[model samples]
Every structure is written in C-alpha cells, then in structure tokens.
Target chain A: MKVIREKPAVIQRPHNFCAGCSHGVFYRLIQECVEELGYSKRQIIAMGVGCNCNLTLSKIDTVDKFQCAHGRAAASATGIKRMRPDLLVMTYQGDGDCGVIGLGETLNAAYRNEKITVFTVNNLNFGMTGGQMSWTTLEGQKTATSVRGRDCAATGYPIHLPEIIAGQFRPAYAARCAVYDPKTVAQAKKYIRRALEAQINGEGYAIVELLGICPTNWGMSPVQAIEHLQKKALQEYPLGEFAGGEQAELAFLRQEAEK
Target chain B: MQMAKKIMMKGNVAAAEAAIRGGAEFFAGYPITPSTETLETLSFRMPEEGRVFIQAENEIASINMVLGAAACGARAFTTSSGPGMALKQEGFSYAARMELPYVVMNVQRWGVGLGMLDSGQVDYLRDTRAGGNGDYRHIVYAPDSVQELVDDLYEAFDVSQKYRMGVLILSEGYLGQMMEAVELPPFKEIRRPDWGLDGTGEVGLKQLCPTYNMALAHELLPVRQERINRVCREMQRWESVETEDADYVLVAFGLPARVCVDAVRRLREEGCKVGLIRPKLVFPFPYDAFHRVNPNVRGFISVETNDLGQMVQDVALAAKRELPQRNVPVYCYTHSAGVPRVQDVVRYYRSVLDGAVKEVY
Candidate 1:
C-alpha cells in the first residue's frame, strides 16, 4: 500500500496574488495549521469574499468551501457554524473588506465572541482594485483616491481594529501580528495557530491582524514594501497578543488534541 | 377534540421557544423593542442546554456575533426590530452573501427613522426585497398567528441550513404582543459536528477559511447566484387558500393575510365572488402560484399596514407579468400607525367588489 504525505485539500493553482501581498503567507499559515491539526479535508468548511475572496477556493481542494459576497463571509460563516458546529469554519478578510464594508460584522462577531477565527490582512490600501485609501490607510499614505497623502482631517484617522475588537469583546485569542520578515512571519503563524486552536477548543472568537505589504498598491518594489512595513507600519500598528493565552497549559492541551 | 392550552406568550417569546426547540444553541442579539423578549428568553435558556448566548452591546455587534457562532458550525440566531434591523443590514448582507444558514427575527414597527413600537408592516418592502445594498434575496417568512410564529422558527433554521442562505422571520408588533394557544413541539437536542469553531475538538490543518477579496469574489458570483436561484426555486413554500368557483382574490401576507382571510369569508357569505391567497414565504413571492390563480380571478385587493402600500406594488408587478391581459384592478388599503382590523379589510374588499373603490397608486 502506498502512503500519501501531502495535505489533502490544497490545489496547485499558480499564485496570482502579487509579491509581498502577505495573502499567500496567510494562506500557507492556515494550511499548515489545518494539516498539523489532522482534520479530515471534507470536514473543513471555508468561506471568502471581496478583494482577496476567491484565494481559498482556487488553491484549497481538500475542504468544502463557499465564496461569499463582499464583507458577508462572516455572516455566512455564522450560519455555517450554527448549522454544523462540528465543521471547522473560518473567514479570511482584507482591511477594506473587514474594516470598512464589514466593520459591523467584525465588531458583532467579536462582541458575540463567536467561535470562529478571523484572519484579517491589513495592507492599508485596497490592493486588488487599484490603490485606494481604505479605512485602515495611514494618515499620510498616498493612494488612487488620495493622490495627496491621506489627510487626517479629511479622511479620518486610521482604525486600529485589534485594539477596537479587544475593547469590545473577550475573544479566545486576539493579536495584531506582521509577516514582513521571517521572525514576525513566524510570530504571526503562532498567533494564527492560536486563533484556529481557539476554534477547536470552542473558546469562541479569535482574530489575527496581519500588517501586510501591498507592493502593487504601495508603488514600492517587493523588498522596499517589506522595509516600509517594518519601519513605518510596525511602529503605528504594534504586534502583540491582545487577549487570552493566559491559560497556556490549557491552550496547549487543547492544541495537542488536534494532533 | 382536546382543548388547547392558552399560552399568553408574546411573539418574541414564541420565537425564542421555537428557536430553542429547533436546536439553536448559539444566540447573539442586542435588545430592541418588540423583539427584546426573544433575546431575553434565549439568554436564560441557552445556558441550560449548554449553548452559547451573548447580549451584544448593539445590534451591529449582535449580528456579527451570530456570524462568528454560525461560522463555527453552530445553529445561531438573532432578533431585532426596525432600527436595530437596519443597523444589522451590513451583517445580514454578509450572512446572505456568504451563504450562511441562520435565522433573524424582525419584529417590524413603523418607520424611516426611529419608528415607534407600533403595529405596522412598513418594513415589508425593505425586509422582503432590499434590506442590504446588493443584488441578493433573503428567505423571508411572515407568520400571522403566534402558533405560526413558533412553528416557523424550526422551519426557518431548516430552510436556511438546507439552502445555505439567511432566513428572515418578519413579525409585527401585533403578533409579538398577542396571546394565543400554542402546542409546543417536543424539544430535541441538536448535535453539533466537530467542525464548529467552538475549538473543542481536533481541527484539521486543511480546513477552509472565510475571507473576502474582489478578484476571488468576482469568480464566485455566477456560481453563488446559481445556488441562490436553485434554493429559491426549491424552497418557495407558501400558505395559500383558494375557492375554485370564486371570481376575485385578496392577496396579503403576515398579519394582513389573516385579516384578508376573514374579509374573504365575509364577502363570500354576502354573495360576493372573492377568495384569498395568503403567502407564507414572502421572499420567493410565489409568482408561479400567483399566475395560476390570476387567470380565474376578476381583480385583486392588497391589504397591508404601511403608509405606502409596498407589498401592493409587488402584487401589481406579479399581476402585470402573470395576468397581463386580464384587467385585474388592485385596490390598496394602506395604514401606517396600526394594523387595519378584519372589518376594515372586509370593507375594502366589499368596495373593490362593488366597483366603488378608488385606486391610490
């Protein structure tokens, strides 16, 4: 008998996401967590929508997935979770998708502390639909609409989602992490793992905000974009745990249950 | 015949009972008038069943919490009315677009702003057609009696789960406050699968994630719409009554439908040729069924409790497409402050039958 040693569900689709996009990194991290957790491919239900919406359906093959509408993936995931509490469900959203169009959903999910993990990629700008200033865009960040730097007086201040969510609800795990470099990327993965593990433990809502680089939208080379994220974005959006993990022993026990 | 126990249950309580009996283990809702009872009841009962219940700070957060719970594969629900429902529009839209199976109870009151907790069906149009800004439809069920309210709770969850769509239980202030005898179904414990986001079991590393992006979203629209259409076609169930020998039909839904039925019976007894068509599922509109009855009926009367007869417009559109050649004149009885009584509906039906009614639109 031949033994297969690959994750059952990831498709071999060529990566269309731009370099330094961080979506690819996020996807890999989620895939790694699922693989390590040892869940059956068919048991995993995924939903996605908006700019980075179809990323999962095109790449992941081992799980049941649904592509939802703009900023509505959380809502659909809510329904899925209600109907099939046995299936691992999660939603990956972008800053524009989650913060602006989906702010209500993000806040509500956190407030209710629903047992789902939200992976939010904050590139500050809307990367997919030309560079546009999103709600999370920094005050001086330039974009298609704000050819001039984003003015605090005109565009409002950049939203700190993790802080806002932490204030609203006690999620099982909440953190703002980055993937601009190897160390932070590893840290981000750990946070991602913690959030997903929270779901497995029925610990309620978990979220990870990845301070990602939008090379295309930022008008910087991939290397320059990483450097920019490290220097400028990290200072404004610090990376650290926002909630839970106080019971490290309990979390580890629950994490081991997946293996 | 056995005497049914008279339960002085509010509409919200009935809805809550139905949700609990139907195996809803997760409920997140912010308190609002007319619908607050549903959340209040769930807050106490869910924990008894080892379910998750949260009283969110606001309706926006309430609906989002529902989204989170639903994503974890739990049977989740939320309840609100008028303004609260409006606030929840974004989350509701997300639920529908994401193809999530959940139930929302809307105890509608009058309004464009902070519509008072009055007995009006003003939200019929918004809830039925365009609650959120997008090209999508929700499975809307408008129950008239307290019994229907309770029965439809289970039906709402079942339909939502089967179709992967959001189901709206549109109740009004009258129904929410009215007391009626109800036979409660035996409660059954819902067994949640390991995939729910509750984080209790071993999660596989390959589970799908919920995320939105434009490039990926565009590709799924065609498939998603196709799925929606399929669900709409298969699950378009409605409560309809007709007399084969009748000449006219009175079309209504929710509480107004009950009034229409009373009016139809009174008109028929008075030697008039009028019947009734009460739709239970208001979203899928029952166009084909309406068309089947359209040819035989001489005219139609639309009864609602809104300032501008919103549902009447749907009847007109259906009549235009269903019975184009038939001169089916529609008379609307629009009242915003309160639901028109049975006598009021009967009066309108009689006038329309007597050719003495004036067309408002």
Candidate 2:
C-alpha cells in the first residue's frame, strides 16, 4: 500500500495572507515536514511580527507558537531552546523582520550555533507594510519606499543571507529555495525537511530562505509573481544548499558506501 | 548545625549570589557600569550550579532571553545600569504583557542619555513609576544597603512568581560597588509550573503561547488587568521608623533613605522632632504605611538624589489621604546625582519644623 498524502502540523483554520501569497505554500511545506518528522507533538515555534507570522498563530493552533517582538524571533527562540533543550524550537521570520531590523539577533543566533531552525520568507519587500523597501529588496525594484527603483548606491544591495550563513562555521545547514511552481514547491519541502532534521539531530543552527510571493505588494497577478520568482529571484538568490556543503555531501557518501 | 558564612563583598556580587540562592537557574545579561559585577559573578557561578548563563550581545537580547527562559518555567534574571536598562524597555514591556515572572537589577548611575558611570538616583521615576511604556507596573524594591540588596534579591524570585510579574531592585552605585559582610540564604529548589511552553510531547496536552497577541484581546485584557490589580494590592511592603511619634515625617528611599534614617536618629538625639518613613517596595507606593503615621505629624519632607523629587508626588498623595481636613506641608529636597549630604537633610527637616520652608502648592 502507498500513502500519497498525510496530515500536516497546521490545524484546519483559514489563513490571513493576501491572495496568491507564497506564505501559504511555505507554511504548508513546514507543517508537512513537522508532521513527517514526528515533531507535531513536541514542536515549539517563535513567530516574528509579520504577515506570515500571524498566520502561524491563527492557523497552526496545534503546535505551541510564541509571538516575538518585530524582528526578534531568533533571540526569543534562543531562550526557548536554552531553557528546554529537549524540545524542538524554530522561528518564522520575514525579509525585513529577519534581515534588517533583527539582523543582529538573527546572525548572533546562527553564530552561537543554537540548535534551532529559522525559516525566512523573503518577499523582496515588506509585504505587510504595503511594499516598502527591505534589506532583501532587489536592485531596480520599485516598492512604496523605493519609488524610483532601488538605487544600488543609496540602498546598497540586497543582502545575500544564504551566502552569509554559508560563510559562517556555526550553522550546520543553510539553503535558499523558492515555492513558485509545483517542482519548486516540492524542492522547498525538501529544504524545510532537511533544516528541521538538522535541528532534530542537534547539528547546530539551520536556516532555509524561501523566496515567497507577495502579489498585492508586488503589484502583480499570481502568474506574474511566479514569473518574477522564476526569472528574477532565482537569478539573484540562487537555489541550493549553501552551508554544510562538504560535510553534508561527505556524510551522504559515507552512508551510501556503508549501505 | 553550621551557620551560613558571612563574607565581605561588593553589593553587586552579593546581588548575584543572592539571585543564585533565590533559585534563578538562568541568567542572560549584558555588562554595564555599577552593575557589571552582578553579571560577571553569575557568568561563572551559574554554570557551577548546573544553571544557564549567557553574556548576551546586548541588553535587548539579554532581556528577550529572560522572557524566553521565564516562559518555559525557568527562573531567569538580568542586571544592568542606566543605558543598558534603557535598552531593555522593549523586552520589559513584552514580559509585562506576557506575564513572564523574572527579576531585573538597575544599578543606578547619574545623568541621562549616556550619563556618567557613577552613583546616582535620578532614575527613581523611571525605575519605580513605568520604566517601560504601557499601563503596566513592576514590583520595584529599592535596597539602601549591601545587606538589604542581598536580602531583597534572596526573596525576589518567589515574590515575582507569586504575582507572575517582573520584580526590579533599584540599587545605586554606592551600594552596588561597596563591600559589606552579610549572611547568605540557603539554596532553594523551585518547582516547575505545570503550564509551560516547553512542548513535552505528551498526548492530549496543548502547547502554551506566552504572548498576548495569540489570545483574544477582549478576553485577555480584562483578566490581565484584574491580575495586575490583585497582585499590586497583595505586594505592598514598606517600613516606617519613629514616624508614629514625631512632629515631622521624612520620606526617602534607596540610597537617600539610608542618609535620611541616620539624619532622623541624629535629629532626635539633638532634641528635634523628626522621623523617617522609608519605602522598601517603591511600586504600590506603600500608601497604607503613610496612613498609619500619627495624625499629629504636621508635615512631610521628601529627600531624594534625583532632580526635583520624583517620589514626592506619591508621598504627598499618601499624606493627603491621611489628613483630608487641613493642608499638610509637603517639601521636596532634591540633590540630583550628587552624593547625599546628611547635614542637608537635617537642615531641611529643621526648616520645615520651624515653618521657614514654604509649603509646596
């Protein structure tokens, strides 16, 4: 007998995201991974003050969810893990929430190699705040704050988070993925599963940066948003496991050889 | 049976030791002037007791860590001075809303906006009145001496948890940096709460959410307000010395209270009718203690090391409740950040008694 589907960790509740928002896909993928990993009963999540974060509390009533101060999900998660190391703890943050305002907490948590998972929904702009320029906003991209297209000179450049995490020795896993289409959605699921697995195994900090869609904030239709991710986001933030590059491959090879 | 050893140590170190004795299993703190030794002591001592200690990246992170640990049923605390305490306001507000019981120490310093790293009590208003924005109040204890600092911290954990609120020990640098011999309390083993967000993975049990946003506002706000009011009423603690039989009452707290107490004794020895009323618990202001004073006490003088008396308002209000018929003279003698001069306090008490100091209208 083959099982094609299983229940997810998220409870059956209506989400509050805008139509065509990719946050729903990320949420579903994360819940599926949690359900598969048998962490549904012992999962604790720290939610950032953002649109996607709000849905996790309202929709995902099954798991314990803590609401963190804007951009302080990492710090709060660190507290949970330190106090209750036996439990699985993770944080859900957005581009502006994780990258700019809470960059200190985010980076320090990774540097400390805290045994937790961080899932960042990078939508290029601050979606909940009506499309303001974020640290992850693309060059030449026009947001409410970046009226004349983001100037590379004035706003610097979009921060490459996975690249930065990969450069660090603390994070055992760090990857960038998108959830635009069916294939990419499946790939995003794998990234989320692997990140959770790393935390479960106490392999130090793990992070998965998901290039999510904000159709309303981007001023695009569902189709246009998918196209933008496929064409632009994928080019700028390449999808792959950036951190734990050699260690993960070697472990995989060793396991295959042993088998 | 062996008695506890009394060792001469700085007030900050004693505070750290007292926290450990009080069963604080987790300490997340950032180093700041006057209060740094408290964190430094806990950094090494906490781990020895199988506790968690983290020197956080900043004050903001430290306080957030406290909120996290406290949510999971761990006794956690943090210590800082003026600038660091200012940075922790956001986390404190969150802790108050979530009702995460913990302790925070503000070793007072002079000035505002990166003020000098010396002894000062100008932060009395901020520390006792709302340190953070909101209609929330913290259980603030102003310990005047090294022994009082250790004693307050020793019982701070239970008191904080009893009310499910944050407790603050507002000690100035003079006490925090000074050394005194004191007996330490025995270690306590705190029982874990049944309702914690640790996700024990047990069946038929739901995970707990510590933030107020997750709960319905209309349902939670009223309950939270009621809990706060009840706790405030039950946690009012203070001390009144010679106030029962005196012509004039002197109100002071923290470091200045020590000076005022000494000044009162000296004034009494010199055949002057003066007494002291010191508030151990600054928050909930100990209004009942003022009402207990002799109605014959014609005046009240508030002595503080802050710029233009902060606690004077509370003192006057308490006195007003005591004597509703006639206007009682309330005088404020402020010294800002400078070290207290006992002579100055004595002179003010004499002037008020002689009717030389005009009543503050």
Best of the candidates, DockQ: 2
Instruction: Candidate 2: give the clashing pairs.
Output: none
Q: What is the lDDT of residue A244 in candidate 2?
A: 66
Best by TM-score: 2
Q: What is the C-alpha lDDT profile of model 2 across B1-361, one tens digit per residue?
A: 8998889989999999999999998899988988899988998999999999998899998898888888787888999988999999998888777777899999989888998876888777787766677767788998888889989998999888877779999899888999999998898887775656857433211323333554476667776678767866787778788988888888888888888888988998998778888998888788888777778888888888877678888888888886787578788887787667889898877777677877663
Evaluated at residue A254, the lDDT of candidate 1 is 87
Model 1 chain B: lowest-lDDT 10 consecutive positions:
B204-213
DockQ of 1: 0.17
Kindly list the per-residue Cα lDDT of model 1 for residues B1-361, writing each as its tens digit. 6755666677778788889999887887888887788888888888887777777667776676677666566677888989899888877776664556678889888776988878888888888876777766778988889989999897777777776678889899889888887877667667554443333223421133223346778776677668667866776666666645567777778887887777777777788777777778788777665666736677767788888788888788777877887757777877666777888887776677577877643
* Over 4 Å off, model 2: A1-3, A245-248, A251-259, B200-222, B353-358
Per-candidate TM equals: 0.76, 0.94
Model 2, residue B67: C-alpha shift (Å): 0.9
Q: lDDT value for candidate 2?
A: 0.84
- lDDT tens per residue, model 2, A29-91: 898888888877788888888786667545545567777788888988988899988888989
- How many angstroms is the interface RMSD of candidate 1? 7.0
| Worst lDDT 10-window in candidate 1 chain A | A39-48
